[model samples]
Target: MIFPKILRLDKAILATGIMAVLTASAVGTAEPQLPALPQAVSSFGATVCDGYLYVYGGHAGKTHSYDTRSVLGSFHRLKLSAPERWEELPGGPIAQGLNLVSHKGKVYRVGGMQPRNAPGEAADNHSLAEAARFDPVKRQWEELPPLPAGRSSHDVVVARDLLVVVGGWQLRGRSHMPLWHESTLVADLKEQPWKWQAIPQPFRRRALAAAAIGQKVYVVGGLSPDGPEPRLDILDLARRQWSRGPDLPGKERAAFAPAACVLNGQLIVATNEGVLYRLLPEGKEWEKVGQASRKRQVARLLPWDEHAVLLLGGAGGGQNHDSLEIIPIPPRPEPTPEAR
Candidate 1:
């Protein structure tokens, strides 16, 4: 994929200064630093539910370096109100390239990629179709209906008890090739015996971000075989229709592994370039809301409160970060009265 060009020394210096000032204005005052992840990771599953932040399996090694010890199954959660520490929680398989979602008070984890080779051996990765839900009251994972087929690098969202999985590819290991998926998998969580139903998706892409606003699912950019894309596809559950929306704002680099979530009835997205944007109510354009202090790709963006979000655990500055940045949401621009 063609990413945005790296800034030169002079431009980098100027940008850093502006970022500091903007971050200061956004923060407003000194606040206690929140807890960081127990380890630096990326491509993990993360979400917020019932005043707690939960994270699950992620990649812990260098780029393209995978092993038994490197891919982590570790899971953790932080009580948002107390904000003192990240409590250890029950974890599942050594996997990556998935998303964690919250529905009611339970959190769900879907498909991901698992590596079976040793550190120095050739890659032997397998895409998984496993699905499970966590019970905070009992503190364990309960089995759920798995996907129809193996998939990974996809995103999941919970809306109206419907568990939706979208945009991932299937890894068939080193000897075989990977295949991009062209359909979306959905399961009704409230049903007694959960069964996955496949619905046709218009596009085939992985590493995309998915968010729900009302009954619609917004699919944002990711790397396609055609390379980086900024296209936005919207799925209306009511009509079961797929239509194009506004492209993501800023450089296409932002399109690759962008962070997205719903907050304050708005779809907020942050890019690898640190630019923050939101979908206007009209849904015709994306507005520049603000930016992040640290720019990271594939970070988890989840609602922290009514006015802020937690951007957690992604690769940045050539290294993985364990830091969690609190980004304050900017108010929408007032609508201009039409001139008569």
Candidate 2:
């Protein structure tokens, strides 16, 4: 796959004085700490709405197995100002592995899967194509038009006043092999019938992360047919075409289900390997910032504010984690006069 050219830092600028300043700044900055989740969860969806962080259906339990019984349909929210306290909201309609997005102060949940019987057997696994919107004020869910197909582990983002659902996987055949998708669907919320349109397919992958940086929507990091893909696909809304973005910097091609968000006009992505990357506005490359406190896969990254982001529940190193950690993205320090 063709990767975008990344701008390299000038070696001459890294003088001893400049290096010292960088070192000091790194040491002086405090590491942001994450608070524990109310319960252990993985394959869940989270978003910030109305000053509260909302977490929706996923696998929940102490043991980190894929048992269907572990799937939950409950909803919970935490006030950003007082994140320590969590209040349980009304239950949702679906089980785990759904795509959750917030639009116009309301939360929309789309597509998920659940086991058909007890013991959470894979043979009885069922993928859902239903869609619904939750009204926090009414404490109820309103059904919306279903997706063209049932999908799980997809990435959803709101761009151009539309809900864009990207690639994911669907169970097919007796062996139940995961078939990765290349379909891109968009929903127009203003119409009476809830118009849904299919756009040209991008790449085929599952467990990807997506975020809208501007007019364009960026789809990043997932398991491709060849293996874990490190490339980023950018969809230009105006031109309606797919283009490549900078490849993630690491020997590992892809980090499983990394979290992504747009903060302070920059695209911030955190991988399961625990590294955080930031893409500046109009930049061709991504810069490594710091590491997450915990290495997690299938985690949800929610932007808390301009300076802070919350890494929610996910599995790590074959074990599930209920821990919640906050990563602070401070402004880049300028070189001091001593460097000159």
Candidate 3:
């Protein structure tokens, strides 16, 4: 199986000065600085619930490689106001690759991977379909109905009171080449008995970033069969159908799971190269905003409020980062009279 092509600076054209000016001008205002994480980690699941940030199941230490031993099951939490002080929570049953999402003040851990009971063994065969819901008030985890099939590196978002599991990868063979998935799953949170219902996907990919705006869910940047996916897809929960959106700017694959969130009625996406883009609700294209504080891959974006977002742990330059950066989303500047 062939891996997706990773984009490098030498292979792609750099951003023009005009684009830089547009981004820099948008971020001219001052914003509060964000604190770093308690420790460095990557491939972790994170979410915001009840004004607290929760992180779980990720890899730690520098292996320079993806190994099962590096997979961690630790759980941590901190108040968004004081992120520098973290509290250890009860660990989850599984290891890394799970996706976390919050609903009605509760946190849910979705499908992910775990290592088989062998020392230094590959975890390809250990993809999981199990899921659990955490009650922050009680500080307990309750088992929930599992998914129909095992998955890892998938995107999960809450839309219309349902949990939607998007595309991801499943290990195929000894080579562990990822078999990208196009199947979508939906779970009705308010149903009498919880169950997963299979749905159709517009495309197949894995390690993508997603955000929900109003009734629509926007999925962007992932590893497709050909390479890094260039198109953005939006799902209309009311219609239960997928529609195409604008393509991403530049040649960057947005690889290693870039971060995305909805801020002030606009969609904000941060690529692995630390570049940020803004998309209006009614706009046809994505506009470059500015660069984030750090260049990291596989990071998680947690919205603090309408004006700011917290970027969690990820890897960069062959090492996992323990830092957290605050990305401020200022209102779009008004067009000048000359331009108008």
Please report, in order, the local distance difference test score of every candidate based on alpha carbons: 0.85, 0.75, 0.75
Show where candidate 3 strays beyond 4 Å: 1-35, 61-64, 117-125, 172-178, 333-340
**Model 1, runs deviating above 4 Å:** 1-31, 333-340
Model 1 residue 210 distance off true place after TM-score fit, in angstroms: 0.7
- TM-score for each candidate, following the candidate numbering: 0.89, 0.83, 0.83
What is candidate 3's local distance difference test score? 0.75
Cα RMSD of all models vs. native, in order, equals: 7.6, 9.6, 10.0
State, as a TM-score between 0 and 1, how close model 3 is to the true structure.
0.83
Q: How far off is residue 302 in model 1, in Å?
A: 0.9
In model 2, how large is the Cα lDDT of residue 188? 75
Per-residue lDDT tens digits for candidate 1, residues 1-340, read 2234434447877687776676566667434589889899999999888888899989888976877788899899988778899899889899999999998899999989999999899989999988998999999999887888889999999867888999999998999999999998888888978888888999999989999877788899998988888999998887888999899977776799988988767888888888878888778899887678888887889876656777889887877889898877776543211100
Q: Give a tens-digit lDDT track for model 2, residues 1-340.
A: 2223222435555464465466446446444344577778888888988888888888775443444567788888887766667899887654676667898889988887765555644345566788888998998889888887778878889875788888887754335666666778887777777877877766888778898866678888888787887878988776778888888878555456788987665678998898999865445788887578888878888776656677889887666788887676766543111112
Model 1: lowest-lDDT 10 consecutive positions: 331-340
Model 1 local distance difference test score: 0.85
Best by lDDT: 1
Say which prediction, candidate 1 or candidate 3, comes out ahead on lDDT.
1
TM-score of 1: 0.89
RMSD of 3: 10.0
